[model samples]
Target: MPLIVFCGIPGSGKTTRALQIKEYLEQKHKCQVVHLNEEILQMEKKEVYKDFQAEKFARGFLRSNVEKNIAGNTVVILDSLNYIKGYRYELFCLARAAQTQHCVIYCECDPQLAKENNSKNANNFTEEMLADYNNRLEIPIPKNRWDSPLFHLRSKEETPFEEIANVLLYQAKKSKDPVSTAPEIKFEINFLQELDLRVQSVIDELVQKQQESIQSNVITFSDCTEKLMINKQISLIELKKIKQEYLKITKHNPPKRIEDIKNFFIIYLQKVVERF
Candidate 1:
């Protein structure tokens, strides 16, 4: 079973769709469904959304649960306000690292309807948060690989239950034969130096190509699967900065295979580059 995340404004039927999918999987498919949310987490939604520290703790808690329950025969449905695009990317990476499938189910509705629904329920949530919903939202775009396999369920529309099951279940089962090392990566002290050197070489090559093409807007790594699309002017200094940040992110957790240094770095570069 794969990880299915729900995202939308408050009262946008995220919880509703999550429960529906959970029931659908359990009854229709006879699979164990882990419905992870505030109730299961034993945390108040108000507390989780009240401030930064609280939200961080809550997100970390849910993330841990998702990581643990992502595997096995359980279908993990995370019911939350996953309005943060970066957070969704983190989920995507987790899925990639796990060698599992993941999808985003975005519940859409009129903001006014959402606000009114939230108020009527008034489940310990403040009225002030309603207005911030749209501002806080980082809408998911399907073209973004991280946000791919996305589903949009507006009010009154039935969720694509079979389609959802097909992607996470049938497709996943079809490709489960490969050995997955993402959960158990190992490396040595010398490996760290090699990783640093490998990343720097990639930077050197990219900068060289940039200069060779007289600073072409687009640069491609023929050896790597990742694609880097420049939306604006990029410089050597900026490329170095991106490399450093990428290293920092992977410092404690390098690529699953040492040989994949270039591929992993290029993938990360595209992600960071696209943000600009």
Candidate 2:
């Protein structure tokens, strides 16, 4: 796993830089990046991390995602305001558990400039959020015990996008290992049954609403539901709870028609069960 955690205050250009790094990794190295914040918000159907408690849930979600991506060769970039020290430590533990290489890219920018930029952006946080985050945020200090290299970037004068991108590309090249040779298998009956139930539950909830696709073959509800399945490490009971919610909301299952989704679930379950 290749995990890059960004640490900075609100509006410190963390997201911007993370996206840039993601693009660079994808285009140059042919690596796929799983972004945490965008994936989680759309998946949960609600903002689960508005406060500190929610943040912990989000961190737990990230840990699982990093672990999942470790099996693949792609680099996962965690783009968020990792301002809390404890949260940073939790991320370190996650990387270690996954046995993946990790790095920290500190998006250092002038506070006033970040505030100005945030004020001008559409989804930017308001004054209250900036104040709360700034006041309570504990900055990270570089260390070696974590076994990951940390790069501190002071933005305004030196927006380290290109330089950092180069560094990340170099790291990716040096760390290249042979591609995974695991055998592929078809999904079994039991596995598809479970996935079918879960998808049916989500479709039941999303039936009435018009949802838009954020990426190809990847709708918002799909992303969210997949995250719940992939990241939360949810148990069978929790999945049953989702189905219960669907039953409570719709009082019936949503009719399934598309051959593609049907085929996907069938194949998806096969792959998952085989991996197990």
Candidate 3:
């Protein structure tokens, strides 16, 4: 799992560099790259620039997608301003949790030239907004674990494809020793409580719906006996523990169907019992 994060102000050619790297990795290294920026933009119904809530939503969406991708053997290019060091640290923690390799690419550009470039785009940032972001920008430092393996590039310079590929591919491979160790999964106590509530909510909804359908004679009781197994087998304490592991794999990739959710619960119960 390789996550390449792009950090730069608007009009700093971050997207261009990200795309070039994506193409090089896909073509040369035969690596799968998920361009998260494109996906986020596609999901947006309105303009996100200058809108705090929209930007926050987009970032959350991007994070979920990145989480889902990093769980697999693929490269994820996070094409965004990434001006916040705290956010970068969060991503660094996620990569660590997923046992993936990650790096940061900072596209350094002249402020005046960047504004000039921004003027050419229809969705360009306003001068005030650009200045605000610049003032708040927390440049990544090489010494930071979240920003290590950082690659600095000029706005218009060609991306060093070979160097980037080597860092992500060969260097990452070399770092992985023979002894296989599992990544430690942790969750906040309140978050586990919240997940339990969510699971209970889903169970409650399904049970109510099943009762309604049964009363209408649309379905018989026998049809739901196996489905109700989740309610019977799920213990709050056991659920809290299993849910920690369950969410590690599924928080970003939730089940789409009710049956699948029930199956997941059943499978979780089986695994818990098997451990004892």
User: Largest TM-score belongs to which candidate?
Assistant: 1
Global lDDT of each candidate: 0.77, 0.56, 0.68
- Highest lDDT against the true fold, candidate: 1
In candidate 3, residue 64 scores what lDDT? 79
Q: Model 3 over residues 165-260: C-alpha lDDT tens digits?
A: 888888777655433573333544455455555555544554566545544422122223223222233345665666566666545334443334
The order of the candidates by lDDT, greatest first, is: 1, 3, 2
Give the 10-residue window scoring lowest on summed lDDT in candidate 2: 225-234
TM-score comparison, 2 vs 3, better candidate = 3
Model 1: lDDT to the true structure: 0.77
Error of 1 at 154 (Å): 1.3
Q: Supply the global lDDT for candidate 2.
A: 0.56
- What does candidate 2 score on TM? 0.54
Candidate 1 lDDT, 127-241, residue by residue in tens: 6776676688988889766677899888889889999999988887775555643334456868888888888877887777766765556667756655455646569889889
TM-score of each: 0.68, 0.54, 0.62
Task: Write one digit per residue (lDDT tens) for candidate 2, span 1-276.
Answer: 567888787678887787777787778667777766644544341254466456556656665676677557677777777775545655665564444567787777677888997787666666777777787776666743332477888775454555555545566556544447423334444544555565674544433222332223222354342211232132455435544543332222122332233333322322232223
**Candidate 2 wrongly placed segments (more than 4 Å):** 38-40, 43-49, 157-276
Rank candidates by TM-score, best first: 1, 3, 2
